[model samples]
Target: MSDMRGEVILRVVPRPADINSNGHIFGGWVLSQMDIAGGIVAGRIAKGAVATVAIESMKFISPILLGDLVSVYAHAERRGRTSVAIRIDVVATRGGGAETVDLTSGVFTFVALDENHRPRLLPDA
Candidate 1:
């Protein structure tokens, strides 16, 4: 199912190794997906490379299970001279795509990077 959260930046499925003893996907795995999604949006907005500087806020609303199609959505929420804040939301579709669960949501800040790996001013919007 489509959501109005933002652009669907990444879609993936968790592997068996990504699960914890509780049979749910590890939080780190989910966080990594969000970071990847945020970076993609940030890079597009910056028109160059970008690095994740910080996670302003994050909340895990539900667990992810194996065989679920995970979708990570992201959008630029705020922009600065050299940094942009991307709001990311993750959802898991399960039960043969009948149910969708909100897995996590966060706002990640990314800094535009130059060839020297240092922060650079973002491009015009």
Candidate 2:
């Protein structure tokens, strides 16, 4: 799926190590990658460090096998006083085809943190 209304924050192709025995990408790997992507956007929004507080609505819709290039995109869906709600999407593509399939999707929440690790208010979204 394409985010015509938003911006792309992260794009990556999955490697063999990213696949699980079930022939799909490992859930942890996907989550971690998404977390990294969220941090990228969150840091820019916070103008400093940010910590992941919660991840919700995580749902796997399809499978991703070895050699399947998975592209993950993230964007800020909404903003709160000290937090930002981010929507992340995973897309997979095979060499035989030119199209990409939506594998999974979810929203992540993070809190802006100061240099001393205390929670700080984020800038406007």
Candidate 3:
């Protein structure tokens, strides 16, 4: 992974329950973390309610093993009138030396929402 300028949004350890049959952390679990991280960044940018509109792209670079300390990082990558794209990256620190591995990366899109849950204009940055 290249130098990511995103902020650390979440840090979690994968439990045994998160492991798949293949002995790796479930991909769905990583995806959930990415979504949560993206939402947090989007909400801060929107300064209000926001909803996930799409996961534009995702890449799994490495498998997350049990006992890995997973960190989700995210930043607002793009912004439109009412929508923002957040770039999310997941990294795993393993083997006690804290060797870092790039686990996954994704781009998630979110839209500012009004009280009625419809798209609303984003405020000036």
Model 3: lDDT of residue 101: 92
User: Each candidate: RMSD to true structure?
Assistant: 1.2, 1.9, 1.7
Task: Kindly report which residue pairs in candidate 3 clash with one another.
Answer: none
Tens-digit lDDT track of model 1 for 1-125:
24458889999999999999899999999999999889999989999999999999999999899999999988889999999999999999999989988989999999999999999999889
lDDT of 2 by residue, 1-125 (tens): 45542556666777777878887778898889889988888788888899999997899888776777767788888889888988888777877567677788889998999889988888765
Candidates by TM-score, descending order: 1, 3, 2
Candidate 3 per-residue lDDT, tens place, 1-96, comes to 235647899999989999999999999999999888888999999998999999999999999999999999999889999999999989989999
Candidate 1: which stretches are off by over 4 Å? 1-3
Error of model 1, residue 121, in angstroms: 0.7
On lDDT, the leading prediction is 1
Q: What is the lDDT, from 0 to 100, of the residue 103 in candidate 2?
A: 85
In order, how many clashes per candidate?
0, 0, 0
* Model 3 weakest lDDT span, ten residues long: 1-10
List per-prediction Cα lDDT, in the order shown.
Answer: 0.93, 0.81, 0.92
Model 1 score (lDDT): 0.93
